[model samples]
Target: MAKSRFRSTTEHTMDSKGRLNFPSRFREVLNQYDSEILMVAPWGKNHLRAFPLPEWEILEDRLMTEGREKPDLANFIRYVVGGVAECSLDKQGRVQLPVQLRTKVSLAKNIMLVGMIRHVEIWDKEIWQQDNEATSENFDSFNEQLSQMGIF
Candidate 1:
């Protein structure tokens, strides 16, 4: 299959009502998918992860493969699936994040949308700053380790 292309990083504001106006370029990416449904889940400390319906389904399918034998895998499937919600961009190219997700991520007004290969991560501005700093500090060591594995 062909790889998906993602939009670059964008900084956006979430309205007081928990509505986020997604970048127009990102909306265009979603338009290419069949359902126009975006799936979201918590990502680590204070961030949300967004994936297109197709990509989410692929992940779900892989997770389900271990359902027969692994109890832990079954629990993970349930947790991730239970957290999934369908999202659509409004006419104004905005998406209203469910309140639970918004609060889980500690998202307020300023937010960062970071492009991952198969998904986008929504992060609180402050958390993103700290995460970026740590990643920068470790970049050289991380790259060297990956290169040792012939991954770079």
Candidate 2:
């Protein structure tokens, strides 16, 4: 059986308490895992990535085993692994974004939850807009790259 993947995007506002509704579509995908928790962590300077517990474990295992002696990999493990937060979905279908994680990613009121196949990305709305625009402008080049990679 094929693994369920996240898809599409949704715009939402983080409440004053730092809680945002987890998109139902994303929840549907998560449901297949039989897990209620997400391993939320910083994806970059401006966004966060959330993985289901099982997926996070797979990644964590690889990070621990494959690059234990590499300095660059150690730094990555420090930043990404150290910053992970286990966020549980509340009954209201909202997940509380930890303050430190939010600050690390520069997230605030306006947010964008983007489906990234294996994981979900939570982006600051403004940053996502600028990045999306740049990607749109460079689509032809990106399309060629994708085609070269046999994606199309």
Candidate 3:
């Protein structure tokens, strides 16, 4: 069986048609989950996240159940699910990121495919460099806080 969580990073290019080669390891994980379709959406201002359809459905269901009683949760649902693009891998395991999404995140030809446990995130090389620097600076504080939650 494939691992339950994805973890790794690799660089790939977006074609002129806005299509990208999904990492082969990620594809194997998707196959284990029995899905070729994914929901791709903006994550923050720097990256796009791809969620396997099956995985996304589970998250959507949870949000639906929880959002009914929380107004902010509902808004989050709209922000994420509302803008999601449903994409399917072609015969060659290529998935097309929407043009608008590419523009919104400033994704260029050179990109990075990052397996971030629950989802895979795509990032522009330059943007990833910037974001990584910021995240690294916060790691110590984050680790300290996370330890209190039994995450250490």
Cα RMSD (angstroms) for every candidate in the order listed? 2.1, 1.3, 1.7
- Look at candidate 1 and give me any clashing residue pairs: none
lDDT of 1 by residue, 1-152 (tens): 55546757889999988888777777767777755678988765578888989988888877767566677776566656787778877778888899988887799889999888678899999989998999899888788889999998
Q: Write the per-residue lDDT of candidate 3 for residues 39-82, one digit (tens) a residue.
A: 99887678999998888988888888877888877666777788
- For 5-121, candidate 2 gives per-residue lDDT tens digits of 999999999999999999988898899999989999987698999999999999998887887766688878888999999999999999999999999989989999999998999
Best by TM-score: 2
TM-score list, all predictions: 0.87, 0.94, 0.91
Question: In angstroms, how far off is 12's CA in candidate 3?
Answer: 1.0
Which segments of model 2 are wrong by more than 4 Å? Answer: none
What is each predicted model's overall lDDT from 0 to 1? 0.81, 0.92, 0.88
Residue pairs with clashing backbones, model 3: none
TM-score computed on alpha carbons, candidate 3: 0.91
